[model samples]
Structure formats: C-alpha cells, structure tokens
Target: MNANKTLAIGCILGALAVMTGAFASHGLKAHLSSYALSIIHTGVQYQFWHALALVGLGSAMLRFPSRRLGRASLLMIIGTIFFSGSLYGLAITGMKWLGPVTPIGGVLLILGWFTAAWSFWRPDTDSVKA
Candidate 1:
C-alpha cells in the first residue's frame, strides 16, 4: 500500500467504524439481540483501532519509508476487513459460517504487528530523521 492510499483507506475505515458503532448503540439496540449488538461493538472497536494504525503507518512512512511498513498496513487492512467484517456479517445475519474467518483475521492482525516491528528495525534511512 502506498502511503497516501493507506492513509485514505484508514480515514475511510475510521469514519465507517464510528458510523457502525453509533448505529449499533442507538439504532440497532432495539432491533438486535444483546449478543449480536455486543459482537458488532467488538468489531467496531477493532476496526477503529486498526484504522488508526493504518493512519499511523502511513504517516510514519513520510519519515521512515519501507516496503515492510506498507506490508504492515496491508495486513492491518486485510485483518480489519476479515476480523471486523466477519463479525459485522455474523451479527447482522446470524450466520455461523463467518465465525471461522475471525481467527484468520486475528492471525493476520498478529502478523501485521510483527511486520511493524520489523519496519522499525529497518526503516529506509534516507527517509528517516537524523
């Protein structure tokens, strides 16, 4: 993911996360079961966090550009889609099939963090601050 693209995606995801959270709390409260609402809430939280992480990754690239950082951002985006997306689907549709995807997303998220750590250890020095 290019830095600009990562930032753009992250911003959009963040906005959507807020939208979904509000809907879950107010609009969906009466319509959805408590269990379902809670699941969506969790999804919103993770989505928001990862969205911010993408934003951060993009910003950091301005000073410490690296392909690894891009990879990290990509993984976070994928993780957000699968992890939060699956929960949203399951909660909204009561579909058990999406449950299995959650762990895969979780794994992707973990890999993202590891890739981020690698980014720090080996940033593009030309881009880094002295």
Candidate 2:
C-alpha cells in the first residue's frame, strides 16, 4: 500500500472503530446481550489497535519505503476487514458461519506483524538511506 493510502485507511478505520464502540455502548446495549456486546467490544479494540499500527506503518514507509511494509499494510487492512467485520456481523446477526473467518483474520494479523518486523530487521535494498 502507498503511504498516503495506508494513512488514509488507518484514519478511516480508527474513526469507524470509535463509532462502533459508541454505537455498541449506547445504541445496542439494550438490544444486544452482554455476550454480544463483549464480542463487538473485542472487535472494536483490535480494529483500533491495528488502525494505529497502520498509521505508524505509513509514517515509517515515508522514511524507509519498503515492499515488505506495503505487504504488511495490505495484510493488516484485509485482516481488519475479516476479523472486525465478521465479529460485528456475527454479533449483530448471530451468524455462526462468520466465526470461522475470525481465526483466518487473526492469522493474517499475525502475519502482518511478522512481516513488519522482517521489514525493519532486514530491509529491502531500496530501503532507508540511514
């Protein structure tokens, strides 16, 4: 992902995470069970954290520009969609099928972190000058 795109997406995700939290707490509290609310909260937390990570990745890319960082950004974006999206859908609709997708998203998130670590530890040839 390009630095600008990553940053934009991160900001959007962060905003959505906050909105989701507020919506769940205020709007859905009476409608949803405690367990459902817990699930939504978990998704909101993970999405918020990943969003911040993407913002950081975008800033780092502006300095160190690497293909690996781009890959990490893509993975994180997809992972957030899968993980948080599924949780929100599942909690709201009680969709059991989405449960399986949550783990796949978790795996993608883990991969994203590993890829980011690799980029910093063993950067590409076209990486930072200093």
Please tell me which predicted candidate would have the highest TM-score against the true structure.
2
Clashing pairs in 2: none
Alpha-carbon shift of residue 94 in model 2 (angstroms): 0.1
lDDT of 1 by residue, 31-112 (tens): 9999999999999999999999999998987667778888899999999999999999999999899999999999999999
Give the CA lDDT, 0 to 100, for residue 27 in model 1: 91
Q: Which ranges in model 2 have alpha carbons more than 4 Å from their true place?
A: 126-130
Per-residue lDDT of 124 in model 2: 65
How much RMSD separates candidate 2 from the native structure?
A: 1.8
lDDT of 2 by residue, 12-106 (tens): 99999999999999999999999999999999999999999999999999888988898999999999999999999999999899999999999
Candidate-wise lDDT, in order: 0.90, 0.95
Candidate 1's displacement at residue 86, Å, is: 0.2
Query: Which window of 10 residues has the lowest lDDT sum in candidate 2?
Result: 121-130
Can you give the TM-score per candidate against the true fold?
A: 0.93, 0.96
